[model samples]
Target: MTSPAEHPSAESPAPVRWGILATGDIAHSFARDLALVDGAVLHAVGSRSLPPARAFAEQYADEKASPVPYGSYAELLADGDVDVVYVATPHGRHTEDVLACFEAGKAVLCEKALTLDAPSARLLVDEARRRGLFFAEAMWMRTNPNIRRLRAMAADGACGTVTHVRADLGFVAPRDKARLWDPALGASALLDVGIYPLTFAYLILGRPVEVRAVATLSDLGVDLAGGATLRFDGGAIASISWTQTGWPDTRASVAGDGGRLELPSPFHHPQSFTYARNWEADEIAEPLIGAGYAHEIIEVGRCLREGLTESPLLPLDETVDILAIMDEIREQVGATTG
Candidate 1:
């Protein structure tokens, strides 16, 4: 746990320069949030083709910052000006993209479900450690102020003898979208949106001793919807459900003998949460911040400034562990990667 001041790289005074690795919707969202941070800059963008990359740069340009556009990801990685690269490529491409960034001597903030499987995640983590390059999954919710507060409260035993945790996230995704149905792209509810609920369970209950799951696969063989029950060593249980075929409640809760915490709908990036002790009135927790992505973006900058190879909040081990859980769930549900 070295402080930023003690780390040698902290001596640098320049703000972090970010290079986005793709021009997808998520990439655009990240660029928008990056604008909200004082010292962070969207310095560059890259895509497989030049037009989309240039178009993204033009679309996201601000008065003070106009990002350089690169025709290919290789060019973006080669840019010396980019201190860190945010890998927004599809799930199947995350491993290659992040590894390339490391090889190019750039730090990384890769999007979540880090890769299609645990083995790929381990390779990335191991490489990051070997290079001492800053790396973290874009689990932005973990950086949310309210989530931080909830974790702190839970750690302090706000919920006495925690026994059960429940979470779910689902939506009716457009079938026409190739990303949602294309087997080549690693499309599945579990890998796509289900990761959120699974992560919520892991955050509240820690790693599970056993994972039991069932899923409904689409005609194309990817999961359309799924559910899992995780049993922990301490006998605590977490039940998580998700779907892409239809919308579910999309709420999350952590309950115990003494109290419970309830996040509002869309708990993954919740604006507020309610806490209740026994029969007492509910206490609502709310914290303000920009489009939610800013927290993780700011976190990447902080870790880079601190000369950290990984975030203390979202360590590489935890990221890999979560992916392993997904791997197991996929195996149990018979959802094979096409």
Candidate 2:
């Protein structure tokens, strides 16, 4: 299996004990990434169901590593062995699950959008602050090296004076009772997948001053597909769209006064980005050792060792800000949470 970039001269390496808070596909992917980092261990797994939890532990744990499986999330939180918890439930469940973890006095890395709305997100941030525990939204793409490099280049004027951004993320899926299509599951293009491209813009340009959105509502009254535009303070604008009804182009581009950069694949896990200026072009790629999540796991470990509660790279404030933007977009487009 692929592993993290080794640090040969390092001494006294400490292992990060992880307690996974869900057993879904994303949770499994994260668990796989965690196992690739040298100083990381899967200490426990939790699910609303017991069988899946045990299966997860068996699949990720080493032969001598006996990771516990908890039927309920509370039991996992109560375990003194777990140093941190990674919450991977659906978007709506994030508010309650994260709050519960904070109440348990455990450090948390909750999934993106942070919560269903701004108010719920505020509660998590306040709770984490009150308990003095580390908390962050799992905006995994923000911590990606290639993405960081791209942002740095943009900041340094390599992409010129950023004038506009366009991005999209979509995948075709059936409209069954699956979480991605169910209104009861809080499924919508914006939250379920739109956040990827939306976040790309947010990471590069910060929050917009004005937001406008429109969507094609599904039979369940959820957004089947939608497009949104954000206008920033400096005349910069971002156009973003997402859909479950159709396959997305899955690409992103940023245009500036001098040049433009384009990613051929998903902006979130981009393999290559092309830099073009004056009719000339060059490509840059940063390959992952495992799945792209290893870097984020490494990041969390670094922050913990350095005694930091939040990472400057992916701050808690940014999480709350993005959720607020999402909430407003939903309201403007007539996508109600209830």
Candidate 3:
């Protein structure tokens, strides 16, 4: 496992300039949220072609002094002004895309399931460390203010000796979307939505001792959905599920002998969490700062300015560990990450 902290915290005079690596849905969301951060700039955007990149830049023009558009990803990385990059490429391309960012001597905030597999994830982490560049897995859920508080509460014994954890995330994914259903593109339900519930469990209970899983595979051999039961020390367990075929409660809970805290529907980015103690449940609200993506963007800017190679909130080791567990789960269920 890699050590957590790599650099001392400090301040910088200039704001962090951001380059967006792809123009996907999440890319749009990140670009929009960049406007909410105090000292962040949407410096540029890149795509395989010039047209979409141009349109994206024009769309988010007000976010910064109109981000410069590039026809190729290499052009975006080559920009001398781009201090850090937000990689919004597909899972299958994450390893390649993030490596380019590191090679370009730029810090990176890559999308979740950092790579198609754990080993590939380590490659990126190792490369980033070798280059002394800041790197983070863009698991935005880990940075949500309310989610942060919930994790702290669990650590502080709010969920006394947490014995059981439950979380589920699912949606009716469209078959027409190639990225969601294509195996070569790293389309696995476990990588897509399953990771959310899996990470939710890991955040509360450290690493588990064993993970038993079952998956429903698409005709293409990609996982469409799955269920996992992870057993931890002291008989604690986490039950999580994900799907791209049906609707689920999409809620999450951490329960123990003392009490439990439950996140509302769409728990990944829940509006709030409810803490129940002594038979009474109280709702705790922590309003998000602009579509909930701003928090991660804010953390990235702060880490760059502080000269850190890794984020404490979403450590690279933890990201690798989570993907490793998912690897086991994927195998047990006879699915591939493409």
Candidate 4:
């Protein structure tokens, strides 16, 4: 059987121990998916307090291993067995937490939108580069099998000079969820949901020469809903939208002179994609592991086994570039720091 990257020796390395910081909802999902990764162990978990940390560890414990629960992030970072740390904190706390991981000489897989601003994201990237540590933005979509196939097909001209793309994601977010509306939490539909569609477009068309965007800001100054029109080379354009206001179809499609492809609702984690050319159409299904989060965990494990500092599939520079684009979009929409 062919290895994922063919970089590691014929013999597999020891299991990669993952240390998770913050027992938030995202961390729960990541931990559960760790079970699906062939060579990964949930060695440790940390939270602000011992109770929640212990609870999370108990819930995800398996016959093979039970993750050590730490009451503080520093305690987890200090653990010698932790090969890497997954920072699941909110956008605002990412920089501080990730930098702490680096200080402890631990590798890191930080959540998407690496930081609230471009400069901070760059700082983290520079630190990882300088330290020669493994680091990646956990933009899980980019690691999806179907999305990877789509990107490859588009690049190979399966869609023939792709000229336009359309994608939107939205839902009526509950006001009680402070993270969805609180600017202090780095809350914004654009940051939370818009990044998916925007990254999808970027994977296909690369960087755009011009981006014209506008948004409807919440009373608190975060963007509740917005849209952006990006113009890429050869005049390819992508129309993207997101909202915390109401339900949207959440569908995405890409068009080219030769054909077009459509992804179902919640396209970011789509189960399949359909491509139509002339009189024929084909729907492609790519099997997903666990809750579809396994792919990323597997990628991280592969990188560690290979002793690589970053993933080739989702480079650090790409993460910084995407964050820079969001920074510009936020500025154009007049989003506040909150």
Candidate 5:
């Protein structure tokens, strides 16, 4: 394992030049975190129009590194200087955007949910593999140091025989938000926010053998809230839920015969978690770091430098499985992505 600090050595290998594919709010957050990474550079930002791209570049500009702004995504993809592209477009646009980047021979770190459906997700993953390019779903939680520690503990049997996992994430998204209510944009609570809890369960329990789910739909025929119960072949079970119409506890827990581990609120990016073993006193595990995005950014840079096509931490196979689960849930709930 290369130390995070060991990136961009004294020999001064050029930093991994990044081209961002959208100028949305999430793109801004990712750009802010990219500045914190030692071996990553925000080389350019693209939007359907040039004004937003210019404004985003101006907001994140640094004296030593200023990103160029492209008026169109195609222009950004054609840039020879960009080594990798971050696809931060809406969920509905992910498939086309990712394929475009892959065709351009650029490595990609696409945002979570990867795509609106399993077939699309598979296409992205398979294409990236065939081309031998670095590709990963940007599930930043999986890259957090503390989450890594928790995963290690589970694997070491610190929680005894894992029996159950429960996780939930929700927030009151405004009714007028186009991304949440518009079906054309792939609007659905399950894809937008539920993915975190689903990913958490998959990390601990692997792929489920059966999935049962239900959901509430908005006027636009998109899911506003939903829950799913997953049963794994190993006799482990996970209950997960999410909503865009209300804020829920947002906490998570994993239980076993011996004890349980409790993740604090906003479980997705937890800085610490409580571990209890049988009758022993509860122990706190806290491994702090900068805003969570840097971890994944660092991992992407590491894999690219190592000539790897996928991250061992968040493999493409696992991403496809997660999306498949979401696809099933969508069918059960009658949420239409069209």
Candidate 6:
């Protein structure tokens, strides 16, 4: 419920320096967003290869900005000028990469599905706290204005206690040995893409008391499609589905005693929501700077600029809780990988 724009520390500090740790697709999106934050500076970029590092740095750097290109992640984290590092690695590499950044005494804003399981998630969080470093899962939806407003409306009884929720996020991923379909790369409908709907339910319903899940595994030995039913203490329930093998509706809707809320397109990057009551319906839209991920990156800048170790909106605890649910869901679906 906290608003970064309203934070009192907004007036007192300079920009937050960033050292990007990957040169992947999401990394580009994040870099573009960071550029929108007035006081945020992109100091450097690092990747496993020299070409990618140089290419990424050139794309985000300005004539005045001195962005170093490092062929190794260690070099990126070693920069004393970098206040925080953004991790955009694969699902399997997240735990190790994030832990390394923490050890280097840099704050981190990692892309989500934080880790493959709960244990790794707990370890990363504990280490961040112990090191007094800011660490947050980039579950960007938590910081989205539309999502924020939706949660507020739900909390204010706009949805009347949120008795039941249904969310589905799925897409047709091209078949390949790459992460999206590769078992070794930790590709699965649930972990790779399903986390959004699962996180959505958690954001609205809190942690569930019981989790029931089922999935259809691909020949690659990874879950290509799945669904889960989560039950909370007070009879509140959530049903979520995800798939990487087929194109799905990819929508999110919450049903309450009085009404329901519907998100039209990218449920996670929601731009609008509709509240319906019998014959009356109203739709509201929320626009963003670019791709909506910009808001989250800007928020990270805000938190660091103010010397805060954790974001009030997307705290590490909520991330841990979301990962715990994912762990359980994975367990029930019998998709176990380290």
Q: Tell me the whole-model lDDT of each prediction, alpha carbons only.
A: 0.86, 0.82, 0.88, 0.87, 0.87, 0.82
Q: Encode model 2's per-residue lDDT on 70-188: one tens digit a residue.
A: 99898998987787889998887998899888777788888776777788888889888887778888888988878887888888898789999999999886656477777777877
Q: What is the per-residue lDDT of model 6 for residues 89-179, given as tens digits with 9 covering 90 to 100? A: 9878998999888777788889888888778888998988887777888888888889988888888888787899889988888755488
* Candidate 6 segments exceeding 4 Å error: 1-13, 63-66
The alpha-carbon lDDT assigned to residue 35 of candidate 4 equals: 74
Please list the Cα RMSD from the true structure of every candidate, rounded to 1 decimal place.
3.0, 4.4, 3.3, 3.7, 3.6, 3.9
- Ten consecutive residues with minimal summed lDDT in candidate 4? 1-10
lDDT of 4 by residue, 125-172 (tens): 999999888899999998889888877888888889899999899899
Instruction: Kindly indicate the candidate among 1 and 2 with the higher lDDT.
Output: 1
lDDT by residue for model 5 (1-338), tens: 12223334335678988889998888988888899898789989999999999999899889646999999999998887887889999888999999999888888899987999888999999998887778899999999877888877887887798999999999999867788789988898999999999999998889999999999998778999999999998799999999998889999988888788889998999888889776775656565546788889989988877777789988888888888889889988889985
The C-alpha TM-scores of every prediction are: 0.95, 0.93, 0.96, 0.95, 0.94, 0.93
Model 2: pairs clashing at backbone N, Cα or C within 3 Å: none
Error of 5 at 53 (Å): 0.9
Over 4 Å off, model 3: 1-13
| lDDT, candidate 3, 302-334, per-residue tens | 777666778998799999999999999988988
Error of 1 at 5 (Å): 14
For candidate 6, the 10 contiguous residues with the lowest summed lDDT are 1-10
Residue 273 C-alpha lDDT in model 1:
84
Greater TM-score among 3 and 6 belongs to 3
The TM-score measured for candidate 6 stands at 0.93
Tell me the lDDT of candidate 4: 0.87
The candidate scoring highest on lDDT is 3
RMSD value for candidate 2: 4.4
> Which residue pairs in candidate 6 have backbone atoms (N, alpha carbon, C) closer than 3 angstroms, thus clashing?
none
**Per-residue lDDT over 1-338 for candidate 1, one digit per residue giving the tens place of the 0 to 100 score:** 22223323556666678899999999988998898887788999999999999999999898757999999999998888888889998888898889888888888899987999999999999998887778899999899878888877777788897899999999998967887888788898898998998888888888999999999997778998999999998899999999998878899888888788888888888887888886785656666467789999878877877667789888889999999999999999889664
Error of 4 at 229 (Å): 0.5
Can you list the residue pairs that collide in candidate 5?
A: none
